[model samples]
Target: MRCTPPPERRDTAFALILTALFGACILLSIIIPSQICLARGGEAEEMNLSSDTALSKLTEGNESPAQEGIPVHVYITNNDNEKLDVSLFIDSELIDHKSISSGSDQKMDRYLLEKGRHTFKITWWDEDVKSSFEVEETRDITAETSVHLYTILNDKPEEYEITVNLVNENSRELEAFLYADGSFKKSKKVGKESSAELGKIKLKEGIHNLSVRWQDDDTKIEYEKTKKLMVKRD
Candidate 1:
């Protein structure tokens, strides 16, 4: 017992001990970094999944009914014989301008509006005509409505020249007679998709009686319309 172990045996034992310790240190260095990497990867995946779910919810909310608006349809027409250059305005803001020919119609693009009262303005070049309407609530998310505008020329500018227009919207032909103050003035033949005009009549400046008589071809019935005209010198 007092004698020391052999050098060879001692050296071999020490070499084995050192080798075991080195292997343990190398295994610990690799395993610790691997566990840390796994933890970080899992956290990153969870964060990305949460972000995608939030984006999906936000997109669905935007497409919901509570975020939608109302829809409006507007139609404009020029019933006069002259070409019309007009502008459309909503709430005093100009939206569009168009040039429409005689007896032609123009439809504006469908617009989205908030629920409430609004003012629509139609300007014929420099002249102005403003109209007000309301948009009511609907059971659906968006409400649909329509408005029509027609420009009619009904004024006399001179004593020697007078213009009267008769519009025929029926499917049958019509014969229109014009009378001023109980006297026959002129006659015009107006058919479907056409208009009749009685121009250049000699009349005095005063309150006068005006009458128009037409026969309906489809119903074989006669209709008469009478109005009072006041001619003034310009």
Candidate 2:
């Protein structure tokens, strides 16, 4: 036969068991919630990192480049006594211009041109008479450049153009030198049976002298021709 413990000792053992059970329940509740929170936080951080990387790649894929050209300037003056309508062109492409009044000047500041030979043309007409005239010049530009043009409108023979008929019959290549009023204008090269261009210059209203000279060193042949041109103005 076994004897039972005293009442005080039995009650103390019961209290100890209850305390241990309560402690175990509290520990389980804290640990399980902490673990769940850690797992969810890690998943959220990974998802945010992936989104940022994709956004960075998409932004870097959509960039672009720069552009380039040559600078140019143009100055125009109207020398006549009437309102004139002017149209300008570069390489046969029309450029916009405003109508100029009598004895007025127009200045165009910065313009972009490509690096090559370009032709500049200006067409002007008298607003009252509707008579139109055109002048053009070509230049090979490697860098920055400037162009100056004058518009002249008159009824009389105020300006004259000098033309030379270059005839080459010799077997050897012949070159001719042109002179205006004893000043050298340009040189022309001519081949056998080919008509060559000698260029033209605007002459003021007067009696002008035009001459052409050519020399052949092999044949020792020197030749010169002179002509008098008269321009009349009203």
Candidate 3:
């Protein structure tokens, strides 16, 4: 007959086996989940980075200029009661012509214009009435500028005045010279965000010439403008 093992020894062996198995299970439970979470978190971070990159690209595209050109805004309004067929010209170049209904307004096609003075002309085409009225206007517009034009009847037909309004929209100051009838009238220095008026120049019943020469201290660019004013003496 074989000798039997001690009861305490057997009990100790069973407890050790159970403890080893429990430790293995606990380690698997903790380590497996941690690995899964790390994988998921890595994927989420990659996706977020891609999304942020796409958004940054979109913002940059929108901020950049559509084309390598300057921006100018031109607005035209029809204040007359009658419908008008309007023809618009810039520097004697025909840009657009359209029929505008009464009391309606329209915007012109945006195009980059050269800096300096430009002649703007508007002609009305009336089928019923043959009118010989044409409006000619001039302005010195820089890059990224907005200009407005309108018509106003003078109170006196014989004597009228033209107002020269100078505004320095640049960052630096500007030295300007005013000329009336081909003669230098005055000189002024206009600061940024400030405006200087050359005052109302009285004119007799004739065509008068007005011009301005200015130098921008920031850009060091010299700009000049010449416009004609026609006055009818009653």
Best by lDDT: 2
Model 1 lDDT at residue 181: 77
TM-score of each: 0.35, 0.41, 0.35
Give the per-residue lDDT of model 2 (tens digit) for 95-200.
Answer: 8677887788887456788899988888887654457788898988799889888887575445666555665655666777777789888887777555666676
Q: What TM-score, to 2 decimals, does candidate 3 have?
A: 0.35
Cα lDDT tens digits for candidate 1, 160-203: 45677766665656677777878887887777656666555766
Mark the 10 consecutive residues where model 2 has the least summed lDDT. 9-18
Give the runs in model 3 whose Cα sits over 4 Å from its true position.
Answer: 1-68, 151-234
What lDDT score goes with residue 161 in model 3? 60
Ranking by TM-score: 2, 1, 3
For candidate 1, what is the TM-score?
0.35
Runs with alpha carbons beyond 4 Å of true place in candidate 2: 1-42, 46-65, 155-234
Please give the lDDT score for candidate 1. 0.58
Candidate lDDT values, in order = 0.58, 0.64, 0.58
